[model samples]
Target: MDDNLKKLIPFALKYKPNIIWNVVFNVLYALFSSLGFVMIIPVMNVLFGEEEKVTKLPTYNGIWELKTYLNDTLYYYVNYLTEQKGAAYALYLIISIIIIIFLLKNLFGFLGLQHLMKLKTGVLRDFREKMYAKIVDLPVSYYSEKRKGDVMARILGDVNEVQNSFFAVLELIVKEPLTIIITLGIMFSISWKLTLFVFIFIPISGLIISKIGKSLKSQSARAQQENGYMISVVEETLTGLKVVKGYNAETYFKNLFTASVNRLYILTNKIGKKHNLASPMSEFLGIATIAVLLIYGGTLVLQDGSLSGGAFIGYIGMAYNILTPAKAISKASYQVKNGSAAAERVFEIIETPNVIRDTEKSIAINSFNDKIQLKNITFSYDGEQNVLKNFSLDIPKGKTVALVGQSGSGKSTIANLLMRFYDVENGTITLNGTNIKDIQLFALREQLGLVTQDSIMFNGSIADNVRIGKLNATDEDVIAALKIANAYEFVQHLPDGINTNIGDGGGKLSGGQKQRISIARAVLKNPPIMVLDEATSALDTESERLVQDALEKMMQNRTSVVIAHRLSTIQKADVIVVMNRGEIAEQGTHDELLAKNGTYAKLVSLQSFES
Candidate 1:
């Protein structure tokens, strides 16, 4: 088995009950199918009256003579029935028995299929769930390097590809080989000489089929990669549709999208062209091998006269039966290769280790005390260039220590490191006196609330979005939080109040409304610490006034780290720290900073001039 294909074994074992029962039914189906062919000779014999006449009942025989004994016994009954009743009666009985055998064959085949459906769908279902669960826990840093659409494609398209090719390979591997083996055993019984001749071509056909699919996995990998890239482009275009339209870059994106799809089209065509060969090559080989067998077996029947005519015809039919499974196995070989490519991609995401996971000795904290401190932290998003360099600060309890800096000055990185969104390269962030990494991640997060510039929202009601902070918060709690954030008046005017659908990312609401709702969410949680990253920078003057008012109310008596792009928002902060490059250039109270007449004083001047 390919290494990637082996990953499926654990998931397959998850449905062990399904596998065991499916194999049982498949074994029965294979038995009845071969037996159906075996009965063909007797049917032809009874129909043509070529059954050997027996004078008396055949004697009981050992297992070695079972075939001859059974044949004699069957002929004796037929002769007796023909003499007593009629030839038509004996013929009807033989035909009816053949029908029953075939019926049982089909019945078991269907039963096997029922269990197969469960195994296929069950494995894929668990696999998709597992991928989604893992993706959710992956550190936020992982998303920075990956495209949204590519991740979405892995969960959706690649999983579906596994369903089509990999799970279907399961059935082909089990049932097809069993059918071929049983049918070959029957053929050998009629004439070992002819079955030996048939065996000569089996490996040859397998070789041709294997050779056809040798490079399919690589080609398929390229195709799926291109497909993921195309999806990433589509995702980027949708996410930045406003910018794309405002800048009139529709043609640029469309042309870029078309180029990716065109590459995918060519790669898939290469795979399909190679994949298409397996069926025709195996089919032609099957018929050609059969033709050679017919002549060899015909010569034996006519000149050698060792094999009976009825048995010869039946053997030929069995040979043809082998062809069906041979064809299926041949095709499946290619599909397994193709599916292996998708499996590799799926497992890539599943096997990635999360760098931000909690340690074995981690402890949960219920409340925060004293202060949160970042001590001599050095960090970088990209490994080569530092984003924060020995950057240290102290945020005391109930104090709003605001971060004021230009873009890329590491203000937001400080917030991220404090919240454990990204761990610092060389320092400790402690909640109270304990290292935040030593605390249970969920517990650490529970003690803090974050409101980012984007105002992330799910497609749910106003109350539902707020409940994300505290899942059990009642409608009254939601309303109280909203009122504290100065958002309840507008929410009350809506048709459904707090129950109204927010739409995607609260598209139905204005920028200020979403920001206030986010503040209300943090207020409802009532965490000991809050981190607000440019929470009102994107708003108009009026919207900023409303959102800023909400932020102030939410931060009351709570330890807060506010990263402010607009210096005006942080003029009253307990302390304002101005960042330069990756380090803190200065830190003091607003009055003390103004007295220094340095970076903080200049930032105030710039904002005043812009206003």
Candidate 2:
């Protein structure tokens, strides 16, 4: 509880101005409500013929003297009206005062709610936006170990719960205390004895409420984690629905989803039961307090006639007011427990160290020159084993290099490292004599283009998809890029041409057409460097040939790094690097490698039979 409270203080402090306004309105509302209860005294005295004539009104001489003086002045005015216009006019004045207090109470209540909502929603928006930015800015290695849906759930669902439930607790922070204080003050003025009794039971109720909420934090955390798992299931199913159907794994996935949801159901029920206990238990305690107050106050009145009927009734009213805020405080205790679990999850992502960040004084390069050098580079996805060890490579300003290797042999790792997707653990990778780490990532990436085997496309028009590579590219430039990538012919034949809307992930397009569009996108980028990672491996022969032609044209006069499984594809490469178990086993042109009769030779022989 202390830890959760500590976490909330920072978020609360972030929106202090809104919190201050909310607190101001809440305090004012509570004060007005209690004052309305106190006003009943003078009006009732006039009605019952127990009115006292006063030459001088009440006065105060110590701490809280101003508050006491105000209460006295209010009572005196009511007395004056009672004397001037009889009991009926005083009754009307009391009714009018009650109406005014009620109005002010509701008005301030609305203002408090408005400010609370503003702060709640504002924090929610900012938190989500910052989380999203962090997610985008984070190194790719982070996502390799994390579920996409889990991240999504944290950003959307869990964050929302924190905003709603956490701020709901905060609303009580101001309202409940103010209500308890004002009501206690009024009750004490009426009869200090009864107010003291009320205070005694409050701690006992608080202790019980706190005990009930003890397990709520762990339960809420489990619920949020299960929610992430459920979302992951949904995301996986959507992304791989075709594979699921093709492999006849629908029932298996359905059962998995059902089990996850069932666990979520059980956890939700647990959380709900814990949350629901707050209202009823608090209500029961309140009833017990009220019953005790009645017995004690009744004994006092019956024994000595010390407590007046009006005063006793008003005191009970104040006690009743205490119940609402007390219940709220208890409920907020539960809510804060729940929100604390979510806040921890949310803050974890927001506070994750950005392992990849630009140097403070890094300068941006306008163009690539000289050569890209990888000198004695070593890297590892996990710290235990190196994926690339003592690796060295150099590509001149305007040449093509193809890296071919078996699975997990550091083919794709080269592409990843070259793009600075993950920084190397040891040694230097430099472009034009400048270390890649020392350059601004955006500027460095802007100078390079990547096209992977799995072509990615959003749901948008062809023109929009192409323009994504370079936002400022003109329509003419897009069309020219499409032509260069051999995509314009099919695109022009579509019913809407460039305006045709591709479905999600380009589901509307054939695999071959998607590859063409991807090539078109790369061509549109016109970056000085291009990285092609088995870009044509997924295509049919005809499509591969067309895309290869487009790629060749795009590669012209550019520093290109190619990863290919087909040895025939890199037959014309200026350099071919064949990796075996994180180290280069063979290097040279296709013929030179085949003549070596080594790993590259065996790979070419195996692929020749498969092709």
Candidate 3:
């Protein structure tokens, strides 16, 4: 609890100016409200026809006399108004005072909320932006181990909860304490004996309410986690819907989804029950205290006649006012505890250390020179076993090198390392004698193009998707790139050509079309280095041929790294490397590997038989 409070203080302090203004308005509001209650005393005396004389003037020490002076000034004003306009007009003046107090109360309330809205929205926006930036900058290994939907839920839902719940704390900070202080001051002035009783009831009620809020943090955390799981289930089902349908796994997925929903349902109900109990419990405690006060105050008035009917009635009003702020404090306590749970989740992502941070001395490379050297490089996704052990390779500028290997063989790891998605555990990968680690990541990636086996397309027009390769590319440039990638014919056939809207994930396009669009995108980038990770592996024979042609054209003159399972695709490569397990077992032209009858020859024979 202390840690959570500590975390919240910084965010709260960030908007201190707004909070100070909010506090100022809240103080004014409480002052007016308390003043309204006290004004009832004088108004009652007037109604009873008692002479409005100061039998006992309130005295003070030092500058404390200022309050008494203000009171006397107001009294003289009321007396003058009465003499000029009679008691009826005096009553009208008193009513006007009450109206002014209420008006000021609402005015200050509005001002407080205005500042609060600014603070809440600003914090929310900043939190979300920071969370997104952190998520993007994190190592790729982080996503591989964590659920995508869980991360999304933290960024969206949890952050929103923290915003709302934390804002509630701001309201309580001002309104609750101000109400308590003002109400106590008025009550003490009226009768310190009665005020002491009210104070005694407050702490007792607070103690009980605090106990209820104790469990809120843990319950809220569990509820948030369950929500993440539910989102994860939905995300997985959507992304794998095609596979699920093809395998007739509807019932299987249904059960999986149902389980997630059930867990979320149960946890949600628990959280709702816990949170909802706060209001009613606090209300019941307040009502009980009010009943006790009524009984106690009535007995005192009846026995001694020291307290008047009017004073007692006015006291009841002040007591009831105390209940409102007390209830709000209790509710706000519960909200803050629940918000702390959400804040914890959000802060975790925002504060996550970037494992792949660039060095301060890293330079930005505008162009590639010489060769990309991988000298004795070794790596592991999980640090237990090396994926590329003692691997040495040199990719020269303006040459294409294809790596052929079975699944789990270090083919993709090479691409991953080249792009600096993961740094090598040992050895140096250098470009033009400068270690890749010495280069800024963005500048390095900007110089490279990647076309994966599964070409991902976003929901947008053909032109919009192509333009992602280079943000400033013109329509003419997009068209020329499409032509080079052999995508112009199919794109022209679309109902709206370059303006045609692709559905979500390019669902409107066939596999072949998506691959061509991806190729067109790469062609537009025109990077000095290109990586083709089995670009045509997922396509049909006809689609594969077209995409392969596009890929070949895009690879021209670029330092290309191709990971291919199809031997025919790399038969004419400048060099062919065959990997077995994590080690390169063979390297040469395709003919050389086949002639040697090594792993590459066996792979070729196996693929031919399967085809």
Best by TM-score: 1
Each candidate: what lDDT? 0.87, 0.85, 0.83
lDDT of 2 by residue, 221-337 (tens): 999999999999999999999999999999999998999999999999988998888999998998899999999988776786788766777787788888888998888878888
List TM-scores for all candidates, in order.
0.96, 0.94, 0.94
The C-alpha local distance difference test score for the whole of candidate 1 amounts to 0.87
lDDT by residue for model 3 (108-201), tens: 8899889988888888888788789899999888888899999999999998888877778777777878887988887887677777788888
Screening candidate 3 with a backbone cut-off below 3 angstroms (N, C-alpha, C), the clashing residue pairs are none
| Model 3, TM vs. native | 0.94
Task: Assess candidate 3 and give its lDDT.
Answer: 0.83
Model 3 residue 569 CA deviation in Å: 1.0
Residue 251 local lDDT, model 3: 97
True-structure lDDT of candidate 2: 0.85
Better model by TM-score: candidate 1 vs candidate 2: 1
lDDT of 1 by residue, 164-263 (tens): 7766677686888899899998788789999986798899998878787888999988888888899999988987888999999999999999999899
Best by lDDT: 1
